[model samples]
Target: MNDDVRNIVLGMAAAGLSAALGWLARTCLWNRRLRRKQAFFGLPDNSESVLVVNRDAGSPDLAVHRYDVFALLELSALIKECGANADVITQDAARQGFGERTEFCVGGPGSNRRMAAHMRAMLPGMRVNVDSEPGPDRLAFQIGSERYRLEKGVGEYVVLARLTTGQPGRARPVFLFCGQTAITNQAAARYLYRHHERLARKHGNSTFVLLLKVVNSQAYGPDVTELVADVTRAAQAPLPTTAPARSSHRAP
Candidate 1:
């Protein structure tokens, strides 16, 4: 009887040990997958994120434009979803060292020079031009053969791009949301935040660029925005031997 009781106790201990090890293994595997999914959206858990906003010193009364504020809010919400926090900074405060961490640069070349520099380096084919005359509808963006113009009653265009600068294991990703006008900027930010999961599933840890069209510009904010094109594959393709000259014609 004593031998039988000892044998039964040993069997129960072995079973409990096996169950605990299985549970631990499953938990570790699940956590690894969750981290990979989060990284696919450029938001790794426990990582630092920065949202660079354009600062208009010319308009001292208004430190940051309303459109930039809207973009900041959208990005902040997304960062929170990633189980991390982001620090919001002005364009003037942004510097080179930021490339080491994940960053979201909001606004256009005319507004955020840092974003413009990165755009020129990472996306040589895309261009954002501002009319010298400066009118209500003088801003335009061009990508490949497609050109988008801002019209008072029609709508505006914005570019949302994700880029990296290192090898697969050590790459630093940056998200750029820019537009010729403030309304377009807001639209792009909203689109990225709303469709991040879908985009992550499609891109799967790759760099991508998207052009979004904001319809009913005169109406409600980003609610009317739509996807115009997915230029990721094209933008990532190697550029031609000779770069094409910038177009000067204003969009009709």
Candidate 2:
């Protein structure tokens, strides 16, 4: 073949490969989302007491979390479906040594903007709250139906449910959901956490353990019934306290 023709053919092949890879990646992500959704709504198992934790490291704050990002997205959708109130907060809110913290900061618009950008990156096409001239001491984002304010901070993935009574870290039957990279196996407990030891150590909010199956270690979207079973088993376990804590936080 002529040199130009050969080059053209190679370019076409590369483009085709790129397109295939993109499609495969998208499909994997979508399938994972669907599975988590099924678990969230009890579609497959008809269980309502399941708690989900999501883990992802693409945050603008780069928090250390437990589950995968995709799982969290699905968990959010699930919470809305169940008509339950859910909120995301910084892991620092769970820090032991920190005397006090503010949910909304008076002088942290820039941080809010960065957090918004991170959310946009993680969840494209979803409506985000980005205040250009936000009021002083404003929060960054809200999750689920209740519009509870969410702040970005260090650590792993967790969706804190607000308790009527004011208590810190007292949520019960806490279900952690996380979105793991199919290839990386880098969920909250995996190797991805090594990078954020400083933030995790600084705050005590990084103590979340998640369970997910390696769907694509060889073949993508394999059965997660066992993983789901594991989650159910964990949910069946008794929680430390029944009274939910007022400290709503998130780390993924």
Candidate 3:
């Protein structure tokens, strides 16, 4: 081959090689970021985890709420993305040993005692209040001075929290996707799965809590959750003497 032709061919090959390497590097960085976000939620690759679903004990058929089921499915998909498989268990069937494993708890304080107890112990500032009267406005979840209530034909609110228990060397991570209503619960789970990477970047591996407002809740389900507040002080703050008082008015 002529010298000029040989030089041109060699340059083209080098450019192609460089492009391939650049693409590979970008892919690797993206995967690394995803893995780091997954790890922040205690979902490590090739790990076994547990999903504790809540069912109403009063129901004879052991029926679960529709939104709870939705949350379970969405969260399961997120776990799979981390290359982990989770064993599904109802709240009644979840035993003491389940606490040792990485867990994702679905439902509100009224339905899931395991998650409620954890919230009380780990995140004492937040509380779920069910109204004594039976009506559409019967439920609300409170955080400190703020109370998020359900308005008929309007919207609802939910809480998403990540916590770690056990010893430092062998900490067991637990995620809480809970709300006053099932719709809100599903919204909370959806928010976490959708924006977990952003959350991981903001908080790193530290424990945190989020309050999300679900707009047009009756129509859109989880597609319209707006961030109402995000709290990161629960892990370091001292426990309060009493839970926040329930407000009779709706959140403004």
Which candidate has the top score in TM-score? 3
Residue-level lDDT for 36 in candidate 3: 89
lDDT of 2 by residue, 47-111 (tens): 32322222233355545333233334444454554344445544323221111211111011122
Query: How high a TM-score does candidate 3 get?
Result: 0.85
After superposition on all C-alphas, the RMSD of every candidate to the true structure, in Å, is 6.2, 20.0, 3.0
Clashes of each: 0, 27, 0
**In model 2, where is the ten-residue run with the lowest total lDDT?**
98-107
Q: Which stretches of candidate 2 lie over 4 Å from their true place?
A: 1-67, 95-171, 177-212, 217-252
Which wins on TM-score, candidate 1 or candidate 2? 1
- The local lDDT score (0 to 100) that residue 236 gets in candidate 3 is 33
Clashing pairs in 3: none
